[model samples]
Target: MCSLAADLATLFVAFALANLLVIGKFVGEPAKPHGLVMFAMIAPVYALLAIQAGVYGIRSLAAVRETILRACWAFAQAVMLMLVIVYFGKIAEQLSRLTFVVGVGFSLCGLILLRPVMARLIPRMIGEMPAIAVVIVDSVPFTAPTGTVLLDARVLGIDPVRHDAEMAARLASAVGHAERVIVACPSERINDWSIALKSLEARGEILVPELMRFAPAKLDEYDHHPTLVVAGGPLQYRDRIIKRLFDVLVAGIATLLLSPVLLLTALAVKLTSPGPILFRQQRLGRDARLFSIYKFRTMRSDMTDHAAAQLTQRSDPRVTRVGAFLRRTSIDELPQILNVLKGDMSIVGPRPHAPAARAADKLYWEVDDRYWERHCIKPGITGLAQVRGHRGATNAHQDLIDRLQSDLEYVTNWSVWRDLRIVFATLRVLVHDKAY
Candidate 1:
């Protein structure tokens, strides 16, 4: 209903704009713009672009920067199509270059501007929409403080509780007014949360763990037992065959093209340091297997084992002059193409962790059991974790945990196109030092 209506509106708007540009350019009559033909052609094209850009769903509220970037891409695709049409139809002479250019430029600008304005206004209008209120009950109010810190800036109307009584009162009130209620309590306070939730459930209300809270630590505090439920095995043989074929094809091609850069990096690392050129470390691979991961040496060989395992700080003393430059620019990881070729890794997957990183006591692993689930796939030379500003040493537990979450998400949504996109994104971030 409403969702379908909104989707249709977005599709129609984009199509109409694209059509105006095409028709205004092709229509021979200068005074008559052939608006009808423009509408017919542009509407379909716009709908296609909108769907491809993921503008139909909740992503329609993407930021100005994202909107502009997507619009530019859509415009480029449209221009390519128009060129093909004109070439085959012999309509180049009939089209007005000025009109086409102006029309595309106007449409792109309008769409980009429209999104940011809508992003700002739409939330206010939808603020009253159904929301899950998280009641944080703890003896010391630890859960409450942490819950407040975890509030997503984008979502509206999340209420937090400080004590059991407060949680009970809030839960009763929300049962009367809100559509849902989630209780976030410490591990020791599970009894209280369960009791409160049961009381609400007795009155017939929906409660789900997925919408409970933002703090991963709070969620993990409750679900501590390993519930072994064997559902389906790993990918079938046919799927594995297809995936491996793709890996080899892409890796082989990439190795051939990137050989020169790899050679130069090796030479640079060797000349920059007195130690070995390649830094080979034991890293956990798929199914918890160990593999030797390769990268150009970016630190002194004399560095202590503790220093190697610890996160490197900005302007680390162990970093050689050339190593600093290489690390910042990500030239140090260029040699990992050999890893890709050797079939020890993929071009895109979870970034492998050192063997020492497997300790569950580590802050990141302590956050959730799913943290190690990232190892379900081959570690990537460059991944969503690295591209999203998660590189270097993690100073805080939350940093590593956040990076792990992104890594798992990348694995769950893996695709060849997504891998290519991540590679390009890594390059852009490295060049700009956006992830340092």
Candidate 2:
């Protein structure tokens, strides 16, 4: 919060200076009050983009160069958004070009100047973090991380499986004020420790020597000691905020702009079929949580497959006349924009698969265990796999494999720009051969 305030302050000062010094009192001319409107438009945009770019993140606070780079990157994006809005709204003439450039330049310089001060002050403000780090040794040969307080499970009488409230409280007290707690236990006790750690306020890690085969995302360093990160949330808090914001923004706009099409589609489905206009089915979402996904009803009411036991094939007999056309043009998916608005989906992500969805004769997860990994992020109306022409029938195991590869690739390398690219790319494949 302090970081946000400091950044806002810097932007405000920069705008004031640009208006006053560059074109105001210093130039012997009255300041243009209207020029401040640019500051109003850009400040919030910069703040949101700054959060997404990690401008106020740990690395930014720790390193001056990283801080400047991230802040500038966010500022540049905000400027671009401002320019687009101005150009499209035909307000470019109303805003002074010189003031815009000078203000932006001053803002960048102000951010650079602000970093050194923040670098020194942030640590003091946050206090010495990980004020306590605890390592619990549970019947395992372990080299404790440096600067951590070591506690022997046997000596402390800490039993992770004990359901007694007193036993849980005792273990909690043992690691008071700890920012991170790493448990080194044999394979059998890992589950117990994991359950116990879930109740604690501190970040938990388990030392599993056997997990090396999987090649975890990255090894976290605890005073130079490495530990695998197996249970981290797919998106960081900042990323979740940014992604959700984008989802809402895009979904809201799409809903408004596409309302006419949606209404026509719904009316056609209702008139052509003796059932509801929407088809809702449970699909695996982030972290494998099940959520009801909405789509325009395409199949006949009696022929609808709620479980999605069978994949839709080209010219499928069950599809109604209007439904076939909707599927062909991908208009049947328009209803999912509501899912995005409801927070059950994203505008761009891996497409969700029904729980009983199969590729060939095998369930999706059975085809490849990595299939579950795609659910790390929210499912989307259209995705990397779909845009790459991997939609429709999953007739063979390899067909699922190809799409899974793209899905996982998307999950691992996600960015706002990548999402935008995938969205635009989707425009080309809306009428693809495989869609039906």
Candidate 3:
């Protein structure tokens, strides 16, 4: 909060100095309101970019060099964005270009000067620093650095195999108030531990030998021991923010634009079916967390499978007459827009599956170990697999593999543009032959 306040104050000062002295006095011209408009546009952009760059984070308190660099980087990007907006809006003639350049220069200088002072002052004012390091011992031999909170996974009843709300809560409680959480477990449990830690509000690492066959995003040494960063919840913090913003914006607009369709679909399901209008089923979401997914009811109430233990089949008798058309047109999945707005899912990501969902009579995770890694990000209503026509029944082992391959591919190489592309591509496959 202190950093944010100081940075805002600096920007205001820079704007005042540039407009009052540089433009009004030196240029001998009436100061136009256009400069103020530009300032308004740039301030929020700077804040968002600054947050993404970690300029107002804990690192700013400990590393002065990084703090200045990140602040400058954010400021530079904000100015560039403002220029783009001005250019596209064709309002460049409304104000003097010199004012924009001078204001940006002053703000850049102010940020560089302000960060070092805040770095030294914040700690003294906040009293004792909070715990920033934690180590979890999960039946593995390890040593922790000095002054770290250490907890035993067994004692806490934390089992990664039981990936449910109760276990997630236990893990979160054990890792409270720590900025970094490291888990030491047997090599066989590395993937399990990674999935378990993905939902926590902290950085997670696993202690493993350097020779382990794991492809980690980063590897750091702790007390001369190797620690692999296996779970960086949402990959990058900036990407998480960007993806979430995209989800909310698209989902919110979609709901507003498609309200009539949603209402008609709800009415159709209610009037045609004997049960409820919407069906809620438990499915695995991001970080292997379980969430109830919403969808228009497409099966007989007595035949509805909340656990998704039975996969839908072609010409299934359990499906109602109205349900078959809904399924065939992919209208049954429209209720999941609420799930996206509720933050349980994304607009584009690996599709979530039920805990007991299986292929070739084998559970998905049992068929392929890499399946667990797909939970690193939130599941989506439509995804790479869906658009690629890898939908419907997973009757064969290779069926699961094909979808899994597309899902992992999406997870490994994600971008906002790719998500947009997938969303557009989805429009072409809504009435696909394999939808049922």
Candidate 4:
């Protein structure tokens, strides 16, 4: 929260300075008040861009270079968004260009200037973190990380020779005193120790891999320490909040902006089809929960088998004339923006599958044990698979595998920037031949 406050303060100060230099009393002209409205309009853009670029990422631990880099990256992205909006909306004609550049420049400089002060004071402000207790068994070949006081695994009640009751007592004692626990054991032994460590309540308990099955696609920081997620099962609480915010903001904006097109498409579906205009189907969402996803109906209502489980193929007889055009243009998917708004789905995630979905006549879950892992996050209306042209019918085993691979890859390595890029890429796929 302090970090957010600091960034917001920095932003306003930059804006003020820019206004002073570019338009106001700095050159002896009277200060104008109209900047307030402009600030309101552009503030959130900077905030979101800053969040996406790791501005609120672990500042206490970051060096001066890292602090500057992250801030600059965020400001650059914010500027790009500002540029896009400016060009399309002709904001340049209404606002001073020098003010824009100076504000951004001041923001970057202000952020860099503050880092040293923050780095000096943060430790004192937060107080020294209770040194984490790293418990590494002898098999893992121990090296202690900086700032953490070591805890003896054997003293903490682990036995390489035999597992026993006294170990639990030691583990309890150790956890009681420690701020957190890092259990570094061999890959095979992590499960047993993880269960044990979890029983003892700690602020955080992490299992570091000596050697693990699959490499993590990304490494992120947690509590000023490096952390790795095997499945990337759930996002960091902050990232999750950001992702949800991104979904709601983007989904809401898109719906409002595309309302005319949405209405026209609905009319097209209604006029060309013999049934309902919006198609709603039950599909597995986050955590495998069934949710009703909305789309503009592109096929005749009578096609049960294909509608229920089978993927549509080229020249599929079920497709209505309007449906074909909607499918081709990908406008049929516009209604699912509601799904995104309603929290049943994300704007970017694994593509949801029908409850009875099949690939090569086998249930998708049956095809890969890792398939269910993809449900760690909400299914998306437009996903990495769809953007990668892994759309259309699923026939052979490899097609399912290919799409699943993309889905899993997306889940394993996801960030807001990555999601935005994928969502943008989905535009190309919508009109590409693969979407059919």
Compare the candidates by TM-score and give the number of the best one.
3
- Each model's TM-score, in the order given? 0.46, 0.62, 0.75, 0.54
- Across 411-432, the per-residue lDDT of candidate 1 in tens digits comes to 6676667877987887677654
RMSD of each: 17.7, 9.4, 5.7, 11.1
- Root-mean-square deviation of candidate 1: 17.7
* Model 2 error, position 114 (Å): 18
Cα lDDT of model 3 overall? 0.81
What would the per-residue lDDT of candidate 4 be over residues 1-436, giving only the tens digit for each residue? 4665687787778877787887774332333333443455566776776665666644344556775687677767766876787789865776666777777778778877877777677678988644444444435665665665666676555652332223434455554434345655666765555445433323334555422444453254443434443332356535766998889889989988999999888888888768888888887666555678888888888883533766778888988888888888889888999899889899998888886667778776557545655665788988888877787777877788999899878876889999899878876667866555
Which pairs of residues collide in model 4?
Answer: 157-167
Model 3 pairs whose backbones collide? none
List runs of model 1 lying over 4 Å from the truth.
1-234, 304-307, 358-363, 432-436
lDDT of 2 by residue, 175-219 (tens): 765656788888897777766664443566787666555555437
lDDT of 3 by residue, 200-297 (tens): 54678888775445545337745656788866544565577678778988999999998999999989988987989999998878756678999999
Task: Please state the error at residue 309 of candidate 4 in Å.
Answer: 3.1
Candidate 4 local lDDT, residue 78: 68
Q: Would you list the clashing residue pairs of candidate 1?
A: 15-42, 15-43, 19-42
